[model samples]
Target chain A: MKPLHISAYTTVSALGRGNAAMLEALRAGKSGLQPLHFPPAELKTYVGFVEGLEHEPLPEELAAFECRNNRLARLALRQDDFEQQVAALRERHGASRVAVLIGTSTSGILNTELAFRRRNEAGELPVEFDFVHSHQLSSLVDFVRRLLQLQGPGFTVSTACSSSAKVFADAWRLMAAGLCDAAVVGGVDSLCLTTLYGFNSLELVSAEPCRPADSQRNGISIGEAAGFAILEREPVEGSRGQLLGFGESSDAYHMSTPHPDGLGAVEAMQAALARAGLASSDIDYINLHGTATPSNDRSEDRAITTVFGTNTPCSSTKGWTGHTLGAAGITEAIIAMQCIEHGLMPASLNTRQLDPDFGSTILLEQRETTVNRVLSNSFGFGGSNCSLIFGGRNDHPLP
Target chain B: MTTLYLDNLGVVAPGLSDWPGAAKVLRGEADHLAEPLKLTAPELLPATERRRSSDSTRLALRAAEQALSLEAAQRLQPAAVFSSAYGDPTITHKLCELLSGTPPMASPTLFHNSVHNAPAGYWSIATANPMTTTSIAAGDESFATGLLYAAAQVVAEQRPVLLISYDLPYPKPLSEKCEVSAPFASALLLSHQASAQSIAQLSLSLDKGPETIMDLPLESLRRGNPAARALPLLAILASASGECLLPYLAEQRLHITVTPCR
Candidate 1:
């Protein structure tokens, strides 16, 4: 796979808006997780919920597309000048030549969840309910495309946690196939009753703030986030980093649980390495999928040890932002790029002690290093797995 | 332009059970019937998992099983692209109601099966094929978008791909908003290399023209279900050869040129 330039990117999560807030939180090791206070469905678990979405609706002209998920997407677009960057891209490649590929597990089902509460006697939902623009999985891509006024091919990938990560791969292929000269790839997922109670039902929601790879770790802290990135065939004037390679695979062993041995994770990582033409030693850091769940951390540990071994430093930023689900891929991918630029590799925030049984080198404290190349892992429900490799343009030569 | 071979086909809709049987209806040899959708667990899944499968998963797997014949199913393990406009409407309705209940306790089985890629996950487990799989959506154009993604994979990876597109109507309150009233699913085994058994060759290009609409009894089916939007293309395959346009993104259409190989 040929390298594509990540010319611009931005994200909004519990850590706050844009790359600056994320960098500040990581540098200070400040976690954005807070006690669960979302109204309606009550759960004891903490969440990385972004405040003020309900108060701030979308602009009036785009009223039909109003939803919490789209609100977050527009918020992220406003930050880091991502909207302007997309506009410049459209000018360079034409509106019809730019594709939108956004990922989301649940686009805006909160509207439907709320509508169900207000159903009338005849079981008819409120007349104002708009399922197509609000709750549909493709609404994310459609909203983003309309916001940016791009007329190219657009779609939404909904493969749970691997959704956003896979969008980068999709963008690369579309560009390689000459379908689009530049592409917009990202993910947006908002906190909803379905996810809160859903994860609780599966026994995967941690009551306290998540501690990835910790000895006393319990489960995940759900988070809502929106992130976007511009992928161009070549580096533009202010290119940030380049997408080196990506690998995707399935566990095929279980739907919610990962493989005990992490064999599928190993396949995805190995494939990414092969595609990037890089050895395990070449990666300076790894952004572990580390949802903080016992099975996930254990399985990912085995996979990491099988490939990169215990020498390479790695940590899960999920401790700070919680598991953003679908947005995790792009969020972590952007963090991997930050590690390349800022030289600050974060520790597993909120984690007290590393799991003694794990063999891999799980970092518990922050370290400043000359990070060149980094690999980020995102594994979703249904055993979908993706691994992405990112690097600084100058230091790591293209394969 | 990239081209892919349609090695095999699968169909599961109101009157369409399988490709061969449905071809008769498409070729005008038989009338299009209005029978309820028939769904059963894909035997590929274990008994326990099969019991836990939802209608969406069953519909998708049923078509996938038909498309991947016993020979190909054993000899070639193709990566899959599962697309649906509204994935598993029944599951979504059930989960919504479950969440709206007092104290709101969700069902673990339903939550896991609610992901858009649930069928893809079940397929991976059923076939034990750990290749890459993706679940995508483009609303009403989900089938065309999935085809584009599958075709891109075939050309870029040079590997066979199984594209399964399915959608089930929502119940009651939700149904009033998005009026998808029927269940439809179809699977196409696409590859870059053509074989002796290849049924048709597909070449896709983007356009802004109108889409090919279905006629007579199939028109309602095509409009009612997102997956059934492939009726025109399927009709072309049933006949000898032709070109048809399917809706893509806003104002864009996927102009597909079909060349019969068999």
Candidate 2:
């Protein structure tokens, strides 16, 4: 796996808009999970919702692409100077040399949900409803690609939670194939009634702030976010993170539940370590795909022990940001990159007591330690799994 | 740009059942009629899993079965890229209607089956293959985008790839708006290893021009079904001469020139 420079990156999670907001939240041990206050007030679960998006208006020219998901994409692109960063990238790489690959589970199904509710007496969608641009899954990638004015290859990877994480792998392969010089790889998934009640119907929604790796952990708290990163062949002067390698695999076990023993999880982690030319012991910390579900934590714990032997510290940041679903890959990837840049180990947020049955060591405090390399794990439904390793520079300020 | 060898092909669309059937239409010896595909479930999957699979999943598995034999599929365990314009509109509509009800709770099975990668997951489980699989979407350009991505992987990794593009019509409200007329699925077994089974070698490069559309008979097919985006390339593979162009990404199309090996 060749190393690609992470020239620019930003995240718009409940923690707030960019890397600074995320870094501050992690260092200050802040939790972004809030009580279920949005519509479907009956859903009795918490979520990491991006605030004030309903008020943010899309530009007139892009009004045809209006939707909660696209609005989140527009807002997230504005933060961390993400738009400006891509503009400079287009200049350096040539607009035709750069590609756009984004991941999203449900692009704008919320808009369709609204259209369905507003169906006319004839059962037709509203007059202004533009199904092609708004409800299409590829619309997310198209929206971002048009915004960046990129002319190279582009597509949307939608393998559930691992969707965005797999984009890093796609960018790497395409660049290796000499197809694209640079790529804007990220994801955005805004909150909607579908996700809110969907998980609840599955009986996987945690009413209170979720606790990962806790014996009493019941289920997950849904979160919505948008995150993006620029990956190029050469490192720029201000580049802070380098993607060393990524490993992807399917569980082949179940559709909804993970492999009870986390076989696919172990394979993804080992593959990432092997590609990075590093052993498990060299990984300073692991960002677990801990969704605070009893089954997921136990299964992943087994896999972690099978590979790393429980010496390295690990935590599930979902306790802080909830589970951002499709946007989680980029959200956690940025957090891992920030962990590499700043020697701050974020605490596994809401865990009061760790389950003693788990074999991996779970960190519960923000440790100011020497962090060199970090492995981030994102496993999705139907057994889709991706593990990304980010590290290059050894220089980091101790918190 | 690298050249990819198309080892074998499988297609299921209205009137055109297989590559041989499609070749007739491509040659104008026969006409492509607008009709529904009569598909049978792939026996490769376990009976229980097969019963639970969705129409889109069945469409992909049927194409996959035709492209590769049982022994070959098991022996190669090829990594797959399942591309679809719409995941499972039936399941999506069902879930939507369920969620809109009075304090709705979605059926967990329907929710899982609605994922874009549901087909890919089913393929992996049915074949018992552990290799990495990806499912992507790119609207009307899904077929071309998927082929380009698979070709790059096959070239860069030098391994055979199973590329499957499948889509189906939505139920009520979405059906009227969406252009998908009928169910369609196509599969291409691509490899860098040239062998006797190889039909043609395709090389593609970025062309800054308008997208190439097929002629009259196939034009409507291409316009109507998103999965029919492969018609141009498939027709070229079935023909001895002439080239085809496919939409790669925004403002750029891939000019593909096919060289027959036979």
Candidate 3:
């Protein structure tokens, strides 16, 4: 397998607008979670909602595709130096050699939902409700491609929470196979009624923000975010970050639950370590996919313990950023990259006391450490799981 | 490069329930297009667990069972790649409906099935395979994506992979979203070696030409009956000569150069 370079990246989450804001928030231990209030209902809960985005106006051409989810995507794409990074990549590699691969569980279905509401009320969908713009599974990827004028292979992966994490694998394959020189891989999932209500119905949404790994940990707090990373086949000196390895596995267990023994999760973590050619002790910190759901946290804790034991520091960023669903993988991946770059590990916020059942080492506060290698996990519904290993440019020797 | 062979193939589409039945229909030996069966949770699922499955889950399980027989089903472990275009639209629509309502409440079952990988999960549970699996969705190109992923997995992991691609007709609100109609499912058991007597080697390449292939109808090719496209390649391969270009989308062409070695 060939290595894929992380040329440049940017993210838009509840923490704020770009990489700088996110890094600053992580450093200051600022929580992006806040109470959310929406029309047609009243539910009191904390959400990692991106502020000021609700009123962000879309351009006339992109207005027809307006929805909560796509709005977040547009806002993320319009962030500081984000468009420039994409343009620079396009210039380095021809547009056709650059691909767009985004992961989003809800794509533009939020818009479709609104259109359906209107249809049900008026007995027909409005003419302006373009199905192509509303429900195409590739809508977000297509939107990004059109925005950046990319002609390469555009795709969207929707494998639940691991959606964005698997994008790294896809980009790696494309680059290794010489299909594309560079690719944009990440995810975007915004807070919509469907996701909130759905998780609530599953009894997985926490009344308050979550406390991952805490004995009293209840459920997850949903969030919205859009994060993108530009990946290349080869690295340029002093340019950006690098992706080490990614491992994926499926547990044929129950739909909503993980394997009781955490076998699949353990296999995926080990596979990632093997691909990166690193040992268990080589990982300095782990960003766990701790949704704070009882089963998920315990299962993940077991998997982490099996691999890293209780020596390495690990924490679930979901405490601060909330569970971004499809976006959680990439959003947290970006956070891990930041940790590697800055030599600091963000604490798992809102978790006062660790759960006795969780036997793995966990970082409770923002700690200064010489971070070299970090592993991030994203486990989704249906046992779709992915683990990504990230290290600094000089952390490992060139292959 | 090592060549991968298609050892065995099975399909449960709108017109057939089994491979031989499908072949018969393709050969014009059968007239009636098999009535599309709506996979009910009760009929296609484990008797005790039927109430827990969604429509898409039922369809996926039924199609997988029809694709993998009792003998082959026993051989399957968790390592499979499931692909679909629109995954569980019924659940997706229900979620959307909840989002539109006051104090939204999404069904737990619906939420579980909404994941694109739900089919893979169901198949793994049914087959008791604990191996690694990947689920992919690539619009109309889902089948090709599955084939590519399966081939890559076989080459990378050195394991025989089961590739299942399925999609059910979208419900009313979602039907307005995409232009697909009628439910269909297709499965292929691919291996690095020729495991059976009827093995076909598929070589795909991008070629420049005016779209349409000689003597091949564009309509039938677009209808997703790959056998129509496969027949020409089979004829050419059987004779040990010639190549067939199959149209993929409008701008792209899948130049399939087939060779038979038995």
Candidate 4:
């Protein structure tokens, strides 16, 4: 696999905007989960909802892409000077040479949720409710492409949770095939009623902040976030991260539940390591897809233990950002880069006790260590699974 | 952007149920229908899975089953890529109706099936294949995008790849706004190695030309559905002659050219 450098990255999550905020929260071992106040209420659960979304508005020219999902995407792009940086990239790569691939689960479905309530007596959707520009899954890619003024190949990936992580693989394939010289790969999923009530109905939402790997861990703390990464054929000056490899698989077990033994999860991890040409021992730390649910954590732990022998330091950042669903992939991948840059392993916050039934090393306290390669797992519903390997390049780029 | 072989094809559309039927329609042996086509459940999927399958899921799985069940596609678990422009609008409408009520009550069944990858999962489950499956959408350009992705995978991995592109009409509330009025799904089994049964060889490259859609007599039916955008490519595959260029990236307006094997 040709190593595609993650030249730049940004994330707007429950903690705050950009990578700095995520680092701050990680260092402080802060938990972002809070009681839910948004609509589609009555689910007594905690969520990692971003603040001030109501106060921010989309750029006037791009207002046609308005929705919670796009707003969050814009907010994320605004952070870490991502938009300006991409503008520079556009100048270098040429707009037509750059591609935009975005991943999203519920792309502006909240708008439809609201519009459904405003239906006329004849039960017709509102004329102003532009479904294609807003609620459609393609809207995220369309909005991002418009805002960035890109002309290269573009598409949207919507395979539940692993959607964004899989984008890294696509960018690799496209660039490797010389389809695009650079790509803007990322994901955005804003808080919406569908997930709020849907996960609740499935009895998968936890009432309190989730505790991954805890013996009594019950369910997940649903979260919303947006993240992006710039993948260039060459490494940018001072770039600390490169997409070394990625693996994707389908559990093929059930639609909603995970494989009891994490078979697909293991296969994905092994494939990522193989693609990266790294041994299992080469992994410095792992960002588990530990959504804090009993089934998810247990299954992920088994997979981790099988691959890394329960000695590799690993933790679930969901306690800090909650499970951001589609956004989890890039969000955590950025976190893995942070680990390589700062030499910090964020602990699995909120888990007071480890699940005795598991054998994986589930870190509970922040550890300051020399980090190199990091593996991040993101498994989605309907059996979509993706594992991404980032960082581990020892030599510094020309500065 | 690598040359690959199209080992086989499967497509379902109005007045067309299989490649033979589609070839006939393209050759004027059969008349293209104007009415929406009804989808049939795939017998390969178990009763329980099929019962839970929506029209979109059934349409997707049936096409793949048709292609993979053929002798040419010996490996049932070829890496799969599923594409849809309008994903399960029926399920989305149903969920909307439930959520629109005073107190929202979501059906767990519909919620699971609403994800764009639901159909992809059912394919793997029915075939007992746990390999990587990707579900993507490119609005009206899904067919071209899916083709590029599948071809790239075949070249990169040096293995046969299964590509399924499907789209179905939504209920009234969504249909009144969305352009799709008919349901369509098509499948292609591609590989780097040209087999004895190869239908045609395709060399894909980005075309910086105008977006070219297929010219079908059932204009309204073809234009309304996104999957029908593949008709021009399908017509060429069935013709066994000539070259074709189809629309791709929306803003780039890039086209993908497909040439038949001599």
Candidate 5:
């Protein structure tokens, strides 16, 4: 697979806006998770809630497409001059040649829940409720495309947790096939009652901040975030990083539970290495999906050991931002980019001690190390799994 | 532009049952009638899993079963692409109803089944396929986007691919906002090389202007359901060589030139 240059990228998570805030939080060993209060759910778990969304609504020109999910996307786009960079890409490659691919698990269903609450006596939804632009799964991509003024192919990928990570592969294939020369790929998932309660129903929501790979690890703290990146077939003067390869696979075992032996996870990791034409030792660090679930960390430990053998320094940023669900892919991908920019590998923030049964070397404190390549993992419901490998150009030669 | 070989097709809709039966109506050899859809769970799923599957999942699995049951495709493990404008509206409405309650009693089964890729997951489990599978949506242009991505996969990986586009009508209150009256699904097994069961060769390109329209009755079906937008191209495949445009992104249409191989 040919490498795609990441020209520009931005993220808005509980850690704050842009990569600087995230790096600062990582360096200070501070966690951004606070008590869950917004959306008014009945759950007692903590969450990665962003502040000031109510004060920042969509512009009047784009008022028709209004919702929490799109608002979060707009906030992230406003950061790092992402929209202007997209405009320059639109100008360089005619507007029709830049595709927009986004991911979202529940786009604006929060508004639909409100609509359901506001139903009339006759069971009729409110006349003002906009389902097409607000609640549809495609709304996230549509909103981004219209806001960025892109005109090429665009669609929404919704495979739960792996949604956003898979878009990088989609962008690569489209470019490889000559459909588009560049793409704007990212994901947006806002806090909603459905997801909040959905995780509770599955008993996967941790009552406290999640602790990855810890012996006492219980469950995940749900989070909301939006992250975007621009990928060009050719590199520009100051490209951020390179998407060397991505691998996608299905569990073929269970819908929600991963394969007991981590078969699918192993396949995804090896496939990514094969696609990148790199050996296992070439990777400098790994961003584990490490959602803090006992089953998740246990299974991922086995997979990592089978592939990298308990040697590569790895940690889960979920402790810092919690599990962003669909946004986890791009959120951690940007974090991996930051790891390359600054020679820093962060520790699993909430985990005080490593699990005795675990084989991998889980980081306990931040370490400053020379890094060139990073592998990020994102697994989701429906047995969907995707692993992405990103690297700088100094070590690996261009294909 | 890229060229792909369509090996087999599976279809399930209001009046159309399968590809063979629907071909006559699509070719104008028989009158199309509006009828309620009756779907059964695919036999491949375990009994318990089948009983727990949602209508959207069953609809997609049924179409994939029809397309892959052919001997030529039976042994080929192809990557899959699933698309739907509204995925499992029944499950969504159910979850919404549950979440609106005071305690919010969300069922675990319903929560996992609520994902857009639930159908893809079930299909992979039934077939035991470990290949890459993706679920996507693009408002009303879901089928076109699905087709484009499937073709791109064929060109990139040089392997057989299964593309499934399906949608079920939403329950009341929600239906009033996004009205899809009937259930519809279609599956296409595409590859870079023609096989013994190849039906047609399609060349896809982007174009501007109005898309191809259907007859009065089928036009309503096409307008009501996003997956039904593939009818124009399906009709061309059922008949002979022709070109038709399907709605794509906001300002562009997907122009497909079909060359019959049967």
Candidate 6:
């Protein structure tokens, strides 16, 4: 496997401010979900809302790109010590060698939609309105690159839930193929009436996000988040973190539902293990893309059963932060990496009764464990599945 | 690296919908695209499933059906990769509207289809292949990204892979960014083994050149017509050897080297 290094990473979900805050929330079994009150609608539901975000004004530089989603991205990128780390990378590897890849379903479109609605009613857009601020999907990635003052291969992946998860694969390929030396990979999705009402229209949103593997599980609670990770070729002997392998599979099964047999999920997990040159038992913790949806949990449970059997400790962080859609992949990947950093596996929240079909291997409560290799699973709507393996530097002894 | 052959092809575009129909147009047997090929969802998809899928999903599934119609059942399990530029913008726009409102509510159908991999998901279920699938989006470079992703999966997994790329014009207002007409989907069943009439080899690289390839119309190229891109490769292969340079991105370019089998 090509050597890939995660030099720096940052995440801002309902889990909290930085990686430390996220780890603490996971350990405490605290959830970031809260009932959101905004425009009057027929249906109201819980959301993984980030507190104190509405008050944070954008910096003068990013003022033009302001929107709920980009605002969250600005705050996430503002993590303590994050800029300094990124700056060092920029200095070391010229801006052109640093690539930017963002996974977002709605890239400030909500802002544009608001502006459009006003314009439609009044027959004109406001004089101060800047359509470029919210129009193209690439704007988010472009904005981030300019803000960071780095240039390389700038790309925006908008593949629904798997968008950001796939960014890791792209970054790995770019670095391995010598396209770029370093890359910033992450996703940003803000909670908006569109997602809320859209999910409500589909009837997939649960009144409450139920237990992931529990028999009584209902559906998922949507959330907004901004999660980013910096990947580069690993340096000599000692390095911050390493990306072992990322395995991807396409089910071509259904638009909305996963295959009943979980074939794609199994293939992805197996492929990741093969890429990492490790057996299933080698994984200490599994950060499941447990969106809490009945079909998703069931299919994923079957896949887990086929791979780890009844041993690996697995939990869904969606209970802490509602499914962040595209951000879920990276958000959960960051959490898995945190677990590897600190030797603890976070428990799944709201889980009381486990599904009889699900094996006992699924961890229901937070527990302490010796961590090394962590497997993170992300399955998107189109049966597009990816399983990423993350481990410490020493996990793979030098060749 | 193993050489991948284009064993079968499928497309559901603005004018062409089925394999025979699309092939006819590609072969210059037909003069125009049909009306059924232009049919929109709510009409094309079943009610039960229609409520769950986005327009992209519908278009992709239709294209997948056309691509797989002639292939055997055993070939269905090949690893799959789906690519798109804009993804489900219609649902995305609706989701945005719901979010800006007082009480947020999301449409389950739209949310389900909003996933970038929804088309891949639908194709897998519709075909019941029980294989691995990957969904990718890379802005304007999606075609190249999709090819790279498919090639990687084939090399890593050592299995045949299905590469599908689709893009639809966002409904009203949002359509400004895109120039293509009607929703379009194209599928290529790529395998390590060569078939009856082999397609040309794909070689990608970074090169400096004039920004545009004036030799071919952008519309025909964007429509996935072989004449503009695929036919050139076929012509090169038929001549025993040939090469053509295609504009990749602004900073990079792709030079395709083609050689026909004896």
Which tens-of-lDDT digit does each residue in A280-383 have in candidate 1?
A: 99999999999999999999999999999889999999998999999999999999999999997899888798899899888888999889999999998888
Model 5 lDDT tens row, B92-183: 99998988787666889999999999999998888888888999999899999999999998998899999999988999978889899799
For residues A200-249, what per-residue lDDT tens digits would candidate 5 score against the true structure? 88999999999999999999999999999999988886789999879989
TM-score per candidate: 0.99, 0.97, 0.91, 0.97, 0.98, 0.82
TM for candidate 5 is 0.98
Q: Which tens-of-lDDT digit does each residue in A1-399 have in candidate 6?
A: 765787778899988888888988888888888776544434457788888877987788778777777788878888856677778889889887888888886677666656545545534545555545654566677678777887676667766777788788878766655567898898999876556666667666888754677788888888889988888886533355678887877665566677776877888899888877888888888889888878888888888889889778898888889989878888988987888888888887888888888773667767887788889988776667788999875567224
Predicted complex 6: CAPRI docking category: acceptable
Q: Report chain A TM-scores, every model.
A: 0.99, 0.97, 0.96, 0.97, 0.98, 0.95
For model 2, the superposed segments whose C-alpha errors exceed 4 Å read: A394-399, B208-211
Better of 5 and 6 by DockQ: 5
Off-target runs (Cα >4 Å) in candidate 1 are: none
Model 3, span A212-279: residue lDDT tens: 98999899988889999889877764556678888888776778888777877998899888888788
Of 3 and 6, the candidate ahead on lDDT is 3
Which window of ten consecutive residues has the lowest lDDT sum in model 3 chain B?
Answer: B225-234
* DockQ of each candidate, alpha-carbon based: 0.85, 0.71, 0.50, 0.74, 0.85, 0.35
Model 1, span B1-262: residue lDDT tens: 6788999889999888889889999999989887887678886777879889999999999999999864466478899999999999999999988877777768999999999999999998888888989999998999998898889888888889999999998887788888896899999999888898788899998877778997889989998889999899999999979989998877678999999897
- Candidate 1 chain A: worst 10 consecutive residues by lDDT? A390-399
- Real contacts retained, model 1: 0.86
Q: Fraction of true contacts kept, per model? A: 0.86, 0.68, 0.59, 0.66, 0.83, 0.54
Q: What is the lDDT of residue B172 in candidate 3?
A: 71
Question: A349, model 6: CA deviation in Å?
Answer: 2.6
Cα lDDT for residue B252, model 1? Answer: 76
State residue A55's C-alpha deviation in candidate 2, in Å: 1.8
**Once model 1 is optimally superposed onto the true structure by TM-score, how far is the C-alpha of residue B160 displaced, in angstroms?**
0.7
